[model samples]
Target: MRAWSGQWRPGEGFGEPLPAWDGPSTLVLVFASPAVIADDTPPDPGGPLAGLLEAYPASVVMGCSTAGEILGGTIDDATVSVAVAQFASTRLRLLTGPIGGGTDSAAVGRDLAARLVAAEPDLAGVFVLSDGLRANGAQLAQGLSDGCAGTAVITGGLAGDGDRFDHTWVLVDGRPRTGMVSVLGLSGPHVRVGHGAGGGWSILGPERLVTRAEGNVVHELDGQPALTLYRSYLGDRMGDTAASTLMFPLSVRAPEGRQGAVVRTVQALDESAQSLVFTGDVPQGSIARLLRANTGELVDGAGEAVRRADLVPGLPTLALVVSCVGRRAVLGQRTEDELEMVMSRLPADVHLAGFYSYGEISPIGEHTSGLLNQTLTVTTIQETAA
Candidate 1:
């Protein structure tokens, strides 16, 4: 596989000229800042995206807006980071569908998986990008897993609108759009995909029982108003519920004979109803506890994720690092430390491109995939033989 990556800014444009590939690329992944996606100005005919599509008409171009873009070992907020890869003897397919509402997220995911699997019986892996605020990430991940039927490994993340949580966009073949989900299917025996996820957060305070909940919203915990109990923990920071809650995400563990514990970050807050909206599901009867972490632990978690990915040495690989936006917020000025740690642990020839997302999607076990929050997830793609 051959790969190339570059960054483009508003006035400066791309840092360097586009590469001259031998032929059309198999995949072109574009991670742009929310500013770029929210721009209302007319599209420039000679812009970077247009130039890319014109150059590789046969390629599958897909990505989404991010809280922050990751390129190489650097992290930037207002730039567009792109990675183009050309694979040998690996087949690719792209599928997209509308996520009408949060309630319909599961169905959309199941339908997309079914279509991809039906078209490519040997589908080896899938990378998904969906509207962060509009879809229930937990349900979407579960639906995709059910539809795949243990035939493929799935990984990716939900689109982010920085900390605003107002709007998010996903790009399919053309321009960015809201209320959409896109998946890239990989097939063929030569394609080898490796994925790993880790979060270095420790539980704090006492565990509470989830008494009332609907989808991703927690109405009550331990028979008390969810927001009421959450505010008690925040104290002074309660003024900014959305941002403050990120510092202390919830650690939820399902009932017996179900998936393991997963983190959940606040997406919104209902002051009047005293409810808290999480990035993923917080099922009733699950045990929940607050979580906290430090910079060293978070950075170490990134290294652990790289270790879990088990990337082969001395191979041309593309490492897609999808980390939680909450981690970026917590890391503050030291955010790049995690990215640098990831780069240090990867193979010398690995090309890294990714973004800070609202929620992460990765397999937690051999046959189980789940939505994760406040964690770093790595997905590596390499061609073993061609």
Candidate 2:
């Protein structure tokens, strides 16, 4: 396998374009900050990506705007990270289609999953990137589980709009577009892929019973309005729930197996109904607990994610890091510390690429992949000797 990574600034131009490769190029991922994509100044994004696409026209290109981009070991803002790869023995296929705004998440996932199998029946794994603001990540993952039928490893995340969370873009065939889900399918006998998720947030206060909820919206918790309970915890920061509550996500333990509680960030507050909306589903009877994390714990969590992925000692052909934007919110100026910690555990030669997402998509236990928040999800890919 041959892989190359480069960084691009708004005016600095793309540092290095994808190198010319004779064989089939597997994939090209572009992670950029919102500022970079919205920049109107010189060296527009089109010119840089245009040149690369002309070179590797056959490569499947997909990505999204990020809170901060992970380019190798450095976490960058107001910049773009470009990673192109050519797998030695893996066959790659790309599928992308429209996802109706706030609706049809499961249908879209099922469609993508079916198309993936049709495209390559022996598909080994799948990576997804979708609109962060308008997609129901939990439903989409479930639909994928149903369609895949335990055949392929499903992983990826929802695109982020930085801290603003107003809008997000997903790259489909090198073009940035909204309300679209891009799925990349990897198939072949020699492709080795490993993934893991880690969120080192500590539970605060007792686990309150979710008294009333529907899908991802919780109307009440412990016999009180969900919003009221959330406000009680925030106190002075009640008015700024969008940004202030990122550090204090809800740790929800569903009314099922001992799979551990999955973290859920409060996406919005429905003041009229005194409800709280989350990025994923919060069953009516789930146990919801407040969660908090410090800078050190966040960084340590990233390292643990790296360890959990269990990558080979040397270097993988490509490594993608999908972390939650909430982690960035809490870390603030020290956000890069977490990325640095993850990089410290990887070999310098690994072609690393990723972004901060609204919700991470990876398996929480041994079976199905799930939509998670405040977690660092790592997926490493390499072509092992045939």
Q: Which candidate leads in TM-score? A: 1
Per model, state how many residue pairs clash. Answer: 0, 0
Q: What TM-score does each of the candidates earn?
A: 0.93, 0.91
Please write out the lDDT profile of model 1 over residues 78-191, one tens digit for every residue. Answer: 888988788997888989888856357778888899899999988999999998878878888988988898899999999988878788888765778888889999998888
lDDT over C-alpha atoms for residue 77 of model 1: 87
Residue-level lDDT tens digits of model 2 in 112-159: 898888778788898998888778888888777667777788899998
Worst 10 residues of 1 by lDDT: 37-46
Which pairs, if any, clash in model 1?
none
Worst 10 residues of 2 by lDDT: 38-47
Question: Model 2's lDDT to the true fold?
Answer: 0.80
